[model samples]
Target: MPFVHIELVAGRTVEQKINLVKEVTEAVVKNTDAPSEKVHVILNEMQPENYAVNGELLSQK
Candidate 1:
């Protein structure tokens, strides 16, 4: 089984998230030899204020 974690700023559309999960699972199944059903995809969406880059908050940037 493969566990894939994806983190991104909040506000992504459902279609975008769905596509991401599909592609990620496919990749794991293809390269890692994991079964499609055994591939786990986790998406963690955080608010801009909760994420920071270069010590600057995403919301501020």
Candidate 2:
């Protein structure tokens, strides 16, 4: 089994996330010889207030 973790700032449509996981699964299957069913993808969506860059919170940007 192959595990993939993806982190992004919250605010994407369900359809977009579905496409993302689908595409990612295909890529992992192609490169790692992992079947779609055996590939696990974890999406970590963070709120703007919980993410930061350059010492500044994303919510404040």
Candidate 3:
């Protein structure tokens, strides 16, 4: 089994998530020989207010 974790800023549309999972699954299948059913993909969405860089919140940037 192969597990993948992706952390992204929140607010992506459903379509974007769909495309991301599909494309990532295909890549995992090709590189690891793991079937789609055996590959696990985790999407961690964070709010801009909850993320920061260089002492500045993403929402403030």
Candidate 4:
């Protein structure tokens, strides 16, 4: 079994996420020989206000 965690800024369309998950699953399955059914992918979307860099919130930038 393979578990993949992906984190990114929120706002992507559903089609983008669908392609991402499908491509990611294909990669994992090819590289690790993990069964497609056993592979898991979790996507974490963070609001701009919740992320920061250089002491400044992303929302502020």
Candidate 5:
């Protein structure tokens, strides 16, 4: 079994997240020999206010 965790800023379409999980799971299954049924991919979405970069809050300049 393989567990993959992904974190990103919130605000994405369901289709986008679905495709991302599918593609990531497929990649792991192919590269790591993980069973497709046992592979897990989790996407964690955080609000802009909760994320920061370069010492600046994402929600604020």
Candidate 6:
């Protein structure tokens, strides 16, 4: 089994998220020899205010 964790600022559509996971699963399977069903992808969506860079919150950008 292969575990993949992805974090991003919230706002993407459902279709986009679906495509992201599907593509990610394919990549994992191709590179790690893991079965599609055995690959685990965890997506963590955070609010812009909860993410920051260089002392500035994403929401402020």
Candidate 4 clash pair list: none
Report model 6's TM-score to 2 decimal places: 0.93
Residues 1-61, model 4: lDDT tens digits: 6899999999999999999999999999999988999999999999999999899999998
lDDT of 6 by residue, 1-61 (tens): 7999999988999999999999999999999998899999999999999999999999899
* Residue 59, model 4: Cα distance from true site in angstroms: 0.4
TM accuracy, model 4: 0.93
Model 1, 1-61: lDDT tens per residue?
A: 6788898888999999989899888888989887899888999999999999899999898
Q: Root-mean-square deviation of each candidate, in angstroms?
A: 0.7, 0.7, 1.0, 0.8, 0.8, 0.8
Per-model clash counts, in order, read 0, 0, 0, 0, 0, 0
lDDT of candidate 4 at residue 56, scale 0 to 100: 91
Candidate lDDT (C-alpha), each: 0.90, 0.95, 0.94, 0.95, 0.91, 0.95
Worst ten-residue run, lDDT, model 4?
1-10
lDDT of 5 by residue, 1-61 (tens): 6888999998999999989999998899899987999998888999989999999899897
lDDT of 3: 0.94
Q: Where does candidate 5 stray beyond 4 Å?
A: none
Clashes of 4: 0
lDDT of 2 by residue, 1-61 (tens): 7999999998999999999999999999999887789999999999999999999999998
Model 1: runs farther than 4 Å from truth? none
Alpha-carbon runs more than 4 Å astray in model 2: none
* Residue 25 shift from truth in candidate 3, angstroms: 0.6
Model 5 lDDT, residue 47, Cα: 93
